[model samples]
Target chain A: MSDMSRPGVIHDLGYRHYDGLREGTPAIARTLFVTGLRHVYGLGRSGKSKVMPFLLLAMSVLPALIVVGVVVLTGLDSLPVSYADYTNQTQLLVSLFAAAQAPVLFSRDLRHRSIVLYLARPLSAPVFAVMRWLSLTVALWLFMAVPTLMLFIGAMLSGLDKSDQVTQLLKAVVLQTLLALLIAGITGLISSVSLRRGFAVVGSVMALIVLTGVVTAVQAIAAEQDADSASTTAGLFSPWSLYSGLANAWDAGIDTFVPVDGAWAVAYALVALLLAAACLLALVARFRKVGSR
Target chain B: MAVVTGERTGQAPVITTAGLTKHYGSVHALTDLTVDVGEGVTGLVGANGAGKSTLIKILLGLLEPTGGHARVLGHDIEHESQEIRRLVGYMPEHDCLPPDVSASDFVVHMARMSGLGASAARERSADVLRHVGLDEERYRPMGGYSTGMKQRAKLAQALAHDPRLVFLDEPTNGLDPAARNDMLRLVERIGSDFGIAVLVTSHLLGELEQVSDHVIVLDGGHLLRSSATGDFLQRTGSLLVEVVGTETERDRLGEALAQRGLVCRPRGAMVAIDPPPSELAQEGAAHDLIRDVAAELGLGLMRLQPDRGHLEDVFLDGAPRV
Candidate 1:
């Protein structure tokens, strides 16, 4: 639209030598990470790719918005949903978001042979792998953070007890971040191995949703039988249960049939970090193999 | 240094490999490949499984060779590969474009990966895509692009970083005849006009003969031949005389040349005459003999030139590898 933007202006500027600052490895990693994050939400991709992420996001925030509206209108003494419990209730949406988007970041490049383009640069395979994992981790965190932020804003506007809401919101933010990291790890590992998009999505769903359902059933049965140890131990198998187990341990207001305490509480946090680390290592190895090919 | 060919590339050595070897378990992908490749357009000629991609990967630090060492633009490929890759652009032989992103966006992203600042990346990406002949088509998603357009997009990304050298692996693989020529011309310009040293690979020896200043032939993980393209196509010291007449007239010319003590043989529609002995190598003696014989035989001469060899002759003559 400026003076140089006239329609008749020539665009064929031929090749010019770039003697500018060619940044180091950190710049490359940062660019890759940014591109990856944009691709996850379909920001720079096709319009069709934008549909699923936004639809799921809208579905996630709609309930929170409705809750805010009801609390403001009815003048309730306290909002029915706890700040930490909102993410728990919308677990399906969060899992669906992660399941649907992880392959877009991790699988497509490998499947389409585009990883060759990235690795051909000054970046190594390990750096590329870590950058991709970090992108998905941050994206998954943002997906949860947006809605949590909405709830916090709504609670503040509704004149709720400032200290309590802020404290519970801080707890929710902590739990969501840890949960995003763990889910990103599991989904990224699965998406990378199962290069096919459908297979990756199914594999991630099976891990995040179906496995958690199974663990929940086992925990319910164990708690009913008065075996607190067995119920607590059942949470170690999947990322969702690990999140809930950690939430229970931290008293983040999400109810669990069995208390995650003592050595088990420490074990939950340790397992989450360990699992994420393991997945990252595996991703780096997988990428190294792909790059070698 | 011992592996020097007949003609130098006239530019500084951009890539040099010494005793370079690579093996995948028992399969040798590259074996003891020692060569000094200088600045210019050098063609890496080989068949499908002849280790072209393997060597590029090792040189780019993407794969580790089993033994030996190499250097690219003065950086040791084994120890200083990051620096090598930083200066060298690579266009892989595979499909590397993601379907959902436009070519402009993809190229800008690749430029950034090469460490260009954001604005510079954008400016460079636009110029490169234009240079590669991608117009408004670059703005559209690459999913529906033709093979030629996709190839151009791939090429544009490689040039986006303005590398000092580029390793282009089979740039004309999927193109039709016209597109192949266009890509070759683009490659030529990239080497000459842009002043970037080029290492382009092609299985078609003849095509590379047209664009490459030097050609290195690899067969079954062995260095078959590495020389200037002109050397491969040099005259074999034999005169090919094409006659405008029937086969009988051509045979008559051959017989006359043979009677004159000149070793001559009929080759299709022409007679191939070996260089005369020094006794008969008098100035204009062989040419006068050829002219007089053709005149007396009532056969018109269509063409007269030295019999230049082809790159394919290297394989046919040696043919030791499968």
Candidate 2:
């Protein structure tokens, strides 16, 4: 050890003030971005993601293969719906991908209290909210996009193209991607607010599947009661109805079958985006209050 | 700024809070707590659910208080928490480490997040790991480590950033006696050698008596006492004099003191004297009387000091014993 009495040693001279860089906006954002990457990668020394990407692909393709096998064996193509039409439905893609993957997106952090470590750092709650939502949205997007693309390509390679198949496939893929983003954003937001992963997952799924279905059923009953103004009655809440109206307006009537947009889809997207933003704001508020302690 | 620069003789307290109260629904975690923790090792002693973790969490900017305000290193906890977090390091009470990552990599990442450059972060992580006595085990994933090793790893990460102030909650919570002693020595070194301001908490008050310069005792959620360790250990105006002899010699000395009308009690080879204040006014008469009594009994005086209770007495009746 060096001399204790000098009081002028190179490093041990005295208590040095840490004249370091101030933690500003960029610093906070960089911390959040790194945390987002860590969330994607999971907590492992070997740099392997705890939640595997291939598992989601497997889940998606397993159902698709079963559907194709049933269609080929039973000669169900004689019905009005062809194999291509059945394969290119947004609802099937959404339910399959979302049913397995959406829970893990934001639920893990809340359950583990890993979010506390992030809030203790430079990242504020709002930044954490946006980053987590974006990370999950991207994760779910990749999980859904690749399998759907494979299905489309495989359908084209097969001998079942009726000229409008290409347009239909493109519409199906685009709409499914948008749907995944919207659903993942809303689910991730809802999941972040809760501490129990199971509760968060169940609550989010109920909000999306049960609540929306109830609203549509109520609107349909109202429309039947007022048959004189069926158009006005259907104006309330129907994502499928809204999309069908929009598709009918377009060259093809993809929306005629899909019915995910009109006034309802706009309202759904807007309300989802607003709820997502509100969740983000609540997260910020939570962090600010915690950090102020 | 004005308060920080004022002319004060003692080292500045890194954390000061007044009337700091925090309630969760009907349960109060901290109630009307006003404490000033100075530089060096200050131990916050209390049992579980006695507000030790709550206090540390509040200091680290992880929980908001229901009432009152506090400052850490002259920064308002409400407005300048990000700044305070940068300056102060915190070691939490629980096992929050990611079990799959090696201590070295995780600590380095934590350091870099605190604004250290890549090379500096790596170097500091290595140094702190060593300082906390982690050898080759530092490279192993925390999942396989024992509880003692995990606590060391946690402490290493808290110090990786070279923070000037550190809040260590139950640093020796689950350690063996030997390991607890080692951890306490390391904590003492952090305050005395590295010159880092330390606020350590423990459920056992005796564990902190030798390490802490000042002690703040909390009970149920209220501040029971906040003072220097010596204040709690002050003499009750009674002297415990030990003589080198048999119990008869001690009894004889006690009998002689009682003959002189000085209240004396026999305690093994010692006699505890309760000298009257009027004797103190006789200008060194109390010292002379004790010397004469020991000489007359032909017994060697081994020790003489004003009687003071042990640190454990503070928690005996659940109030300030002093």
**How would you encode candidate 2's per-residue C-alpha lDDT over B100-170 as one tens digit per residue?**
67899888877766767667778888888888899999988888998899889889878877888988989
Distance from true position, residue B200, model 1, in Å? 0.6
For model 1, state the Cα shift of residue B42 in Å.
0.4
**Candidate 2 clash pair list:** A239-A260, A240-A259, A240-A260, A241-A259, A242-A261, A242-A262, A243-A260, A243-A261, A244-A255, A244-A259
> B1-322 in candidate 1: lDDT tens per residue?
2495647746568888998999999899999999878878999998989989999999999999999989899999878888988898899998988887889989998899999999999999989998899999998989999999999999999999999999999999999999999999999999999999999999999889999999999998888989989989988878889888789888988988899889998889999999887877877778888888889888898888878999999899977564
Candidate 1: chain B TM-score against the reference chain B: 0.95
Question: What is the Cα-based lDDT of residue B176 in candidate 1?
Answer: 99
Model 1 docking grade = high
For all predictions in the order shown, the interface RMSD in Å is 1.0, 4.1
lDDT of 1 at A125: 92
- lDDT by residue (A248-276, candidate 2, tens digit) is 43433342322443564455456544644
Worst 10 residues of 2 chain A by lDDT: A77-86
Winner by TM-score:
1
DockQ of each: 0.81, 0.20
Tell me the lDDT of model 1 at B50. 92
Model 1: which residue pairs collide? none
Q: Please list the residue runs of candidate 1 whose C-alpha ends up more than 4 Å from where it truly belongs after superposition.
A: A1-14, A74-77, B9-11, B319-322
Each model's lDDT comes to 0.89, 0.67
